[model samples]
Target: MSVGWIRPVSGLAASQIVMDDRIAQAEAPPGLYRLDRNWHCDRIWLQVRNVLGIPAPRVYGWSSSTDNPVRAEYILMERSGGVELGKIWHDMPWEERLEVIRTLVGYEKAFVSANLPMHGSLYYAKDLPSPSPSQFLDSVNSIDKGETFVVGPTTNRAFFDQGRGSVEVNRGPWPSLNEFVHSRAARELACIDKFSSYPGQQGLFSGPNQYHPTRALKVEVLGDYLKVATQILPTDANLSKPTLWHSDLHSDNIFVDPSQPTRILNIIDWQAVNVSPLFLQARHPSLIEFEGPIPEGFEPIILPDGFDDMSEETQHQAKNLRAAQSLYKLYEILILRRCPEIAHALHFRDTLPGQITGLASSIFSDGEPILKGMLIQLQDEWATCVRSSIPCPLSFTPEDRTQQKRLEASWSEGVELMHEILTEVGAYQGWDGWVNHNNYPVYKERLARCRENFLDRYAKTEEERSQWIQAWPFEDKTHSPTSL
Candidate 1:
């Protein structure tokens, strides 16, 4: 596929001329051309127009010549000029920046109203070849170890065999929350059982009175967290409809036009779009976190309230940053329910407990005690959930009781230490200073000691060593101002 056209203006002509001079020179009309795979380009352009309500670019159409048997498709559209919002942020005033954000938000609203689903694939643990019939059958056989038999009618079987046999069976296009939940539940159950029976001679379950050495332990722990998460699941099924979403809404995708202060532009990459809940689209942190600090001079744009208030010119640029922040909190809670370890371990790791502890301290210093306080609350919640789910064993020896008590004490101590750090830092800078300040050497040192202590006690035994090795936590390496 290709987009080719005569340049509408001299500026584009100059650019093409310069390009031609630098590369392979061609004496053709000054025009722009983009070559890409036909189906993919067509799908992307169609999706953008459908979701954004923009007209499809004028296509010169498709052709296949004897010299080139492969079909070639082409689109020609007038080029719109604007600076990428990321590059111009610092130059733009604050007010203009806010308008840009508002415009982006509007685009999202329009996409939602169009009823087009965002498209993205979810990662699953099944070791299947692909989401096709062959892989599904293979997975079924692995689990059941039974003789495989084709059960469909002869004609149906023939059709199935004739189709691409290697295509992986996608769990979606799931159009509803109910479908997503049901499918995920089935997948979760399969994973749980698979991990439970995993074979390893030195595994945690090998010895009498030993614990399960599989990653199943993390999954089980995460499941306990999910019991609380269901409370916040959206009950309004009507609001659960799929919407266009940017699966990777990084900073680079946003573009702003200084001339059109109220409008923002999106590159509209359909490859990362998905049909998921509107909430999922809103909850994406990358949408807001990208671009770092709002451009220096740009005024903050206030997002329009509802879809009705949006204009075609500025709709895609008007996302409500504050609302997005609130949605993120809810998303955090929901994600924790589905995959607590994967979610929390990204921030909180035993090897780098200080990263979390420092976060607590910074929150206190920044006058947002609520942030640090959440950690203590989370710990209490975890303890309560564990106590409720796992009953106390009457047959436990004194040593077992002592170990349990120590575990509880350690958790409590961690909370206390976080509180203490917050308080000390809070007294000097207050909460805001703690948050805004770039350094935290003292907190880092304290965290290092705590991590070392944890490793010494829990990672010493063979079983503990194996578990620790298996639990791959993400590492943090940001330097605190205190370190500098």
Candidate 2:
């Protein structure tokens, strides 16, 4: 396949090409693209753009005429010129930052208006055969049982004998919360754990088990939290209407062109795009805090007060951000309530403040104390749930026990080593001025070592281990000079 004179443009993982120097990209074959391994959602992006008539890079042009089969799989897209909104947010004037937020909201609204299929609906087909009708019944029989079906990676059909019978179908477009929870819980948990373990300091201490020092302690805490989560799972009334969403809208995925101000130049990596209710989209604090602290001597484009001053205009945007974050906790609870198997495997329990605080801390890294307090309150609430005789929604298995223990130990040792390295390298001189003045090379080297350790300890096989090592250098190599 020939890419028709397309040339390389800036990108981290996938091959980005500019078509004819004007159109900015040529088409490529499906499943060959590697920005993300999951190619299922990429087709969705092509479809969405086609339906909306948005001027996206061309796709599906692959043929023998293309010079490179690999290059032909992707469309050449014009590289938008701008700094990432994350980098400039803190330094930009407050109004400018608000403008960016407002722009993001508009983009999100546009996405929802497109009425694309929800992720679950796209992936899980009701007409598909299952191994057993009884198995499908099991999924619908109870919340906890349904969750077990949801969280595991295998499609529902894989779990039962399709030859035996057809599974019962729901009447509406949206799956029941029970069904969605069961269907998605496993993948979400796996993705969280896997990505959190990405070979870098940035990935560490960012998930549910960060609080405890030992595996037992972490599991004990998690076990209790699961019980509380189950109790707090939003009922049917809380379920919102389904909409198209960039389910994985985080800092790295969104590109900003400062010149465009109101328009985001590009939203990249649509691997996780899915049709789902707004409620299912998880929040990430890093995305919201794109404009972090500004460096000295650099002229700021967005002012610090913008977030505060533009609060009125951005209140809905802020609410969406908050909702995204809080939904994770809600998911944790719903999964536990729906799937006793997960609870048994992980010894999950419902703790009130502990889970909430832990989630908040993970989201807002800077607000540790407040998050910690919230976690404490969550723990107390779990105790109340226990006393009330609500069926405890947690269970654990030996594998879960072992993994939990290993992760806790890894975290404690990693944090200690990180502190030592930071202290020796002078990276922690107080949050306000420390990151700005720190030696970046030293930080990068230390981070690389941390990544190595994480891969060595947690990765499943040698090949899997090697992949992470290869992926690490790209992180350091791809950033622009102005990024720092």
Candidate 3:
């Protein structure tokens, strides 16, 4: 029952960074052995591998507590020989980097071209019960209930279609695409109420924009706009099609032949792989992007002539920037030729300037200032686009422009309010601060200090905790942010 590793597989062994030293083999066999403490999720690796026929590590044998062991789960896979591409990426010549990009593009293009039953995560459907929306939700909630570190595995079809964002949007296995998108819009808007339940989050739930007076009328008005916008957009079939996306496609996840640096050996980490709308899955691969504004307006991404002459770090950044543009350009071409709706969704400079006006009020997102401006621009574009259509409901009047501005202000106000509350509660330092979970200890300490040093003379009962929380935010019931 025991397996031995002949030697350490340079890029294949479970590194200290990825897993513990305890999960090692004495020798590298024809197959790589992987022991995972929590491998409850069904191996979608096999499904994706078979369907896409992409060059990735092939799993030959696998077992988990449910089927074999009482403790760790194991996967024995054919070892693809290679050095870690990440270990030598920056040092590779420019030609080699371009070759890698060209090869990777081919791999990505092939994987994306494969068809699927629907938009969701891929799972092995054999021996599973037919999926339903309710079953999917129950499975998700059950997964959430389990130990955070140990994800439970299930063959439930419903388990695969979880959506992105702060909440689950596409809780599916839905019967139709229309239902999927409609449900998504409705649920996202509903999340506004959920965010407000937090004492610190009341500010966003209360207002339309940062500058506008709170009014119920404004909230109703925003909701109406969102419903209409979601209905009109996503008209193309590609926007509804299911496609695979590997979110963690960073350098560490890739292996390459050292002698022939451009040849990929294996791609690891498929656990978070999701099959969703092409728009959701079509982001530029991590290796090809640097953290910055997305290249938009169908602009060409160019690497400067002196890119290699620059410092090693600068050269890497330049390559990543160029790669980002190249990848996005490739996706743009694919979408334009095959799926214009998905293409339109991705081109923020063209469609986003209009589509966001409809999306802003319906969806709660971070980066309020940036989003508000984008929505304002989209509204103007939307108005212009609809102006020539006779009897168009989307036509913008001067009053409509004023309403749009009001909505932006109201949304910004709510964003600011939530930030302020979180700050007051010591969960965050400021509106623009990085959300650090590490601050939690400090937050608890501050809370203890506040209760010890700052209790009011009038508050002596258990009800006083609410009073204290309210007092910190100066919660004014008479003047809700959404008030007319």
Better of 1 and 3 by lDDT: 3
Higher-TM-score candidate of 1 and 3: 3
Instruction: For residues 368-467, write the lDDT of model 1, one tens digit per residue.
Output: 2222233334444543423445432223346644544553444454345445444543423222223212244665455456545544655657776666
Off by over 4 Å in 1: 1-44, 54-81, 116-170, 185-213, 219-232, 257-266, 284-287, 290-484
Candidate 2 residue-wise lDDT, 1-484, digit = tens: 4334343323312222222332233344432222222434334455445544332333333222235534333333334345555565545664565555545454454544543322242322232333223223221224443222211122122111211012232312334444443333322222223232222232234323243222233334433444454345433332333444554455555567666644565566555445444444423223553322323322323333456666665865654444433333333344345532332322222234223422421221122332233434444464453444664444555665565556546556546644654454444432211233235566657656766666666667877565545433224332211110
**Rank order by lDDT, top first?**
3, 2, 1
- lDDT by residue (tens digit), candidate 3, 1-484: 2354423333232332133233343233556655433242234555445445556677665554444432235555666678778899878887687677666656666556665555544433332345433223211123332211111122222222112233444455444555555555555444544444322233444321133222243244455455445444555566545666566677877899999988887787665565555554555567766566666667677788987689999998887777666664665565466545444545532356234543442343232333434444545565454443523333446775676566666656656655644555664442222233456467666655654444443346657645544434332132212311
Question: What lDDT does candidate 2 reach at residue 129?
Answer: 38
* Residue range with the least summed lDDT across 10 consecutive positions in model 3: 146-155
**Cα lDDT for residue 92, candidate 2:** 62
Poorest 10 consecutive residues by lDDT, candidate 2 = 157-166
The whole-model lDDT of each prediction reads 0.37, 0.39, 0.50
Report the Cα lDDT for residue 92, model 3. Answer: 89
Clashes of 2: 80
